[model samples]
Target: MSLPDALAASILSDRQLRPEFEAICDCGGRLAGTPSERRALGLVARLGEAATGQPAMRIPTPYEGWSAQEAALHLLGDDEEVELACYPLLRSVPTPPRGIEAEVVAVGRGTEAEFAALAPELAGRIALVRHEYMFAAGHLHRRLKYEWAKRAGAVGFLIAGPLPTRAVAGSSGRGHEDGIPALGISPEAAARLARTATGHARARIRIATEERPETTETILFDVPGGGPEIVVLSAHIDGHDPAESAIDNASGVAVMLAVARALAPHAGQFRRSLRVAIFSAEEWALTGSRIYLDTLPADERGRMALNVNLDSVAGSPNLTALCSGFPRVAELVEAATREAGIPVGTFLPLMANSDHANFAAHGIPALRLVAGFDDPASHCRHVLTAADTRDKVAETELRAAAIAAAAVTWRALTSTDSLR
Candidate 1:
């Protein structure tokens, strides 16, 4: 089916996506529980209302919050000692004022097997590992590595970035007690601390942080159709602060807004209503979506036909739908994207990388629309680092993703069998 002319025009005239993206970046990186996140929330509400022609609904979501006040790494080798730049992973446990000094053990990729192989050597040591591309096949999540490190008796964890200059940033899964102190170091910094046969190098990691209970909202806007079922268009609003978090999520949100504006006018004739969920604290282990899903009544949960979750939708021109084992959703997405003249890849297995996993956990058919999957060359490689800025995403890339998303969302809204 060809794209509707009206929707096409709306998409063409859309200068809003770029500006909205820039606006989000200007909010200073929407780290959860920070003023930046609050500002981003207000922006989303304003933009969502303008796009959907209605007031946005605010659903309060609460969680224990953690923030880093200061973090640093000091290398102490036989002949040299120098301080290095470091970013503490979100929710990482703080070090004492003087910090802990331990021998460094390079753990390679920090996988379960890697940690196990080095288990004996890890005790009282700081385990260092390379940060793999998040979208690459067989990628081990950093959270699990943190868990593995803790279990291996490592006193601290260090993840070296793929890029050369800046340190990487990610969640530490250290929100609970018994979590280890974790920090992200740049490639250069990691190189300096590398262990040689001459001696086992020792280093000190110092981190200062504060903890509190915080509350934020999941922004939602409802666009009606005649059917009893709803199609959820979700994207997380919060992201890491080290970068613009542009590729990680700001792009997903812009695409959602574009789809909302283009779909809102003709929604009355469709088969399902559109429910836009802009979740917060997503970088904190998909917390916002988890809470939102848990509170839904059983009947309400049953009323959802599909979740078209857009996360990092345009770090590259190519897109992949992480289908989460929902074959029907995958087929529908492929058909719509092809019909819209957009190329997209489909990965069938379920992944818990984004907010979509929360919906899938409840037996709801969900698919994550992401820009990069197997392509290590994709802009996703730059995500979670200071290099993930707006320039990494081209306008054409965002447009193609927007068109494909609009097509798929349009079909889901109009189709009689959304997930069948």
Candidate 2:
């Protein structure tokens, strides 16, 4: 089925898109459990209600809450000691009061083979790895690198951000487990830690964090249709504290709001209801969505027809759908995008990098719409750094993404074939 031109036009002409996007960005990085995150959630709840003309249903979820107090790194040489800038990865274990002083081992890209080759030397040493462009096929996640370091008996882990002078930020993926200290450093720091003529370079890492029981909520706006089946459009509302997190997720949330606003008036024509889910703690290994799916009854979850997760959707003009191993779902997305005159490519591999993966894990057809996959030069490369602000996203790019999302969602809602 083709997308209704009126809905498409509404999505394109959404005056609220830019305002909502900027509002979310102004909330600062919506780090889970922070005041900023709470503010963003409150704003999103209002926006969602405005779009769907219904009050939001909030589902409370419990999770391990964590916040960093201080993180410092010092490169120690024979006669010189240099302090470099660094940020603690989320859930990174706090170092001892005096901190951990150890030799640094460079593992380059921190691939499996690279970690294997440096296995013997990693024990009691700090593994240094580089953060690659995250929106790529072969990118090795910082979490994997940290796990490799831990498995190798490393005392600490460091990931150098791709951008110079900017420290990276993300989850350590340790998730309430015992793990070594991990930090994201700038490129300059990585170079300073390179091996000297004498032997391996040594550095001191000190990190302080507080962990406690925390609760966050997922906001749901249901635009009811004629049937019980549902189609979900989700976007993460949380991100690291480094910057605005505009491109990584604020863009997604903005576009989701626009699509919902355009579709709510036409819900009577849809065969399935549309649920706009604003999730939190997504940066912590997709925690919010995982909890949402886990807590939902099996029968209710089975009623889900498809999940179109928008994440980092507009840093670049190029958009690709991470199809989560669903070939049929990919075909449907392609047809929908084509019919809408929007260019969206599909990659069939299942990437557990976003909230959509959790939906796919529950046997639902799911896909993540993202921008600038495999394009290093795109503004998407600035994600996870301090540069992920509203300036990085263009108004045109955000609107196009909204139109594409609306098209795909409309197609799924009106399709006669079984989504399953």
Candidate 3:
């Protein structure tokens, strides 16, 4: 079979793609700014170039270096042990504990007005906040709440999790240099603690960390000879600690590799160039993509036809297409999926929390293709945890997603008219 036909066949053959997924999963947690992430970048650069027969480059990015000297949390009474979940604000506090403990107060929903109302009462207290509706509109609200909580003189804050449906737990206060130590508690644990704090409970938290500002890079690979315009394919090659981020994004990288390989033979046939970007620090607020947008020349930026982003693609039963404001791109994506016999549908505007956000922010047309939002059992659970390993991904789903993505991307890249 030809390359495209072989790609289709291999994608349909479940066992054929397991090795690639396994390789990605084996890389362990590739959190942004970590050595593992750099290694993963190199791996993708090599694999992508080999697959596409095109040159690839590694671009540097700006990142603040951080190191945890000591981090611990425990309830004072009855020696109740509380789990230590990383908070974005904790990086700003002083090293270790300074013998500071305040009364534990429930901040209700921790909204802006709610926080303003309770600001006086929250002064000098450790706030135990609930994440009931925080993730509803993405982490923007949650991040604002954290800032509010910190500004209210709350020495520390604890967030209750298992966020809303289709929402994954994340921290946005990473860049805060003067923030409090925030931690996420399981729902059951948080409920128990909240109930026990009728009068006042004590939380002894300590975090010893170091912060340094530095520059990082985001690599963009361009395959010439297709066309004058370009179709951007993006994936972040970063992972967190402990777990090998096979599903969180390595799946996306693997799919990009597969697509690059499939497109190699027909590199000169398409009417547009293929720009594959391995973005950096996506986990740290889409930093790399934003920088990339800023550096793009005005004329070149306008020439971008469309951005096809692949984040989490393996392990879901149904595929979802998240379209920006443009209706034509959405229609074309739907048509392409239908042509490929792939089950796809429109998903709610979940906010471009990934690399696509930067492009969308600049009014560039973009789409986020994902699978498994409806699958209750399959979600981005081990995202930042040590459990996000390769074993969590399904080879079959990864291959299928890659194939569908290539088909859609190829069609979009070769269309007579520009998608932009």
Candidate 4:
């Protein structure tokens, strides 16, 4: 069967989808388990129902929640009051020292090797590590390094943010629940603290974080048909603080809504089932995907032909698709791009960090489609900050992405040939 160009065009031309993007921005920040996150989930379900005429159900998963109670830092003997901004680490130690002061020591980059080199001097001191390079890299390597510093006998951790070329924000992860107080400081504040410390300066950090084990829902909307295979389309419905998450994933959700609208009328036409999954807690270590994978029946797992994941697709000049495990799927994506007149590019190896990771881990073929980094000014900035508002998204880009995704899904569902 050939691809349906008209369906793709219809999906792309739909302007009603803009309200969904606005709703995302209006939510402010949809951190996992927060009210904003719950509202975003409801919005997604409403969109799905409106497009597909089906009720979507929420699937709950296990998670430990933590909120920073009191976060502060005291410079050993500085009489000058230093105003420092700090965020608590995820899953921080249950009990933290309130006013205990220990000597401060600089451990360079705070890498494993660096900590090993400073083991002798760091035994009883608070480890003040420069997080400048780490922040620029978007908290990628900071966690492991912090773990190493903890093992080296550092009483507490003080991460110095990188010099502000652009505004930077900090967030804690599950690792922070290990019972040690972890704090992030602005670069200027860190510099002042570094200058004031003499030979031995006492550094005191206090963190009161609450950890609660709660079960949260993960919603999956499936449209099953009598096809030999299945094409699964996915998008995560969660975001980080300060970011309204309009571009990061709300854009992806809008694309999913458009796809559902384009495919609903022709659901029975294809020889395979089309599944749309709006995942939860994607930003929190792909929690929803992990749980979904574990619960899938083995027999149903093999029926999955391809998993197409849409993430961050609403604002860019060029669109890129990351084909992680399925080379044959890449060929189909190329065909779709050609039909749509959109360019395609290959990405690095699969990180299995998104919702697609769960399906890929079960040996299911998958592809992650996204907008490239060379987008306009509005879309590029405010990645995880407050700048990821609705105004940053371009309606043209969103329409294009939806059309491209529909093209890819149609081809994948109908094509008999396999890329594996």
lDDT of 1 at 165: 82
Residue-level lDDT of model 1, residues 1-420, one tens digit each, is 446867867886788988888888788779999899999999999999999987899988999888899998999866887998789999999899999999899998888998999999999999999899998668889999999999999999999998988899999876567788899999998888888878667999999989999999999999888888999998998988887888878999988998888888887778888998899999998899999999999999999998999999887777899989989989988898887778578888999999999999999999999887788888789999998888898877777888888888888888878583
Give the TM-scores of the predictions, in the order they appear.
0.97, 0.99, 0.86, 0.84
Candidate 3: count the clashes. 18
Q: How close is candidate 3 to the true structure, as a TM-score?
A: 0.86
Output the worst ten-in-a-row residue range by lDDT, candidate 2. Answer: 411-420
The residue pairs found clashing in candidate 1 are: none
RMSD of each: 1.3, 0.8, 3.8, 3.7
The residue-by-residue lDDT of candidate 3 on 1-420, one tens digit each, is 112565576556534256666676666666665677766777777777776677877667776666556655566666465543433332345434553566677787677778888888888887777664321233344567778888898877777655322112445455755777766555554554563525676667666767778566677678874567888888877755546777778888888777766765676677788888888677666777888888889889888888889888775656777776667777777778777777567654646567776787777788877766555456454454445567667676787788778877888767756555
lDDT of 4 by residue, 1-420 (tens): 444877866876787778777876677577777888878877778888888777787777876665656767767565653446655544545334555567777776677778888899877677777653321123335566567767888777777655342223444344434535677666565665563424765666777766677556676677766675878889887776656888778888888888888887887777788888888767666777877878888878888888889988866756767777577777788877777676566554564546777777888888788775433343544555456677778888888888788888887777756755
Off by over 4 Å in 4: 1-3, 73-77, 94-142, 157-179, 184-187, 190-203, 373-381
Distance from true position, residue 121, model 3, in Å?
3.7
Query: What's the lDDT for residue 310 in model 4?
Result: 90
Error of 3 at 300 (Å): 1.8
- Candidate maximizing TM-score: 2
lDDT of 2 by residue, 1-420 (tens): 788889888887778899999999999998999999999999999999999998999889899999999899999877988999899999999999889999999999999889999999999999999998888997788899899899999999999997889998888999767999999999999998999788899999999999999999999999888788899999999998999999989999999999999999998899899999999999999999999999999999999999999999998999999999999889988999999989799999998999999999999999999999988999999999999999999999999999899999999998756655
lDDT for each of the candidates? 0.88, 0.93, 0.68, 0.70
Please report how far candidate 1 places residue 186 from its true position, in Å.
Answer: 0.8
Could you tell me the TM-score of candidate 1? 0.97
Model 3 CA lDDT for position 358: 79
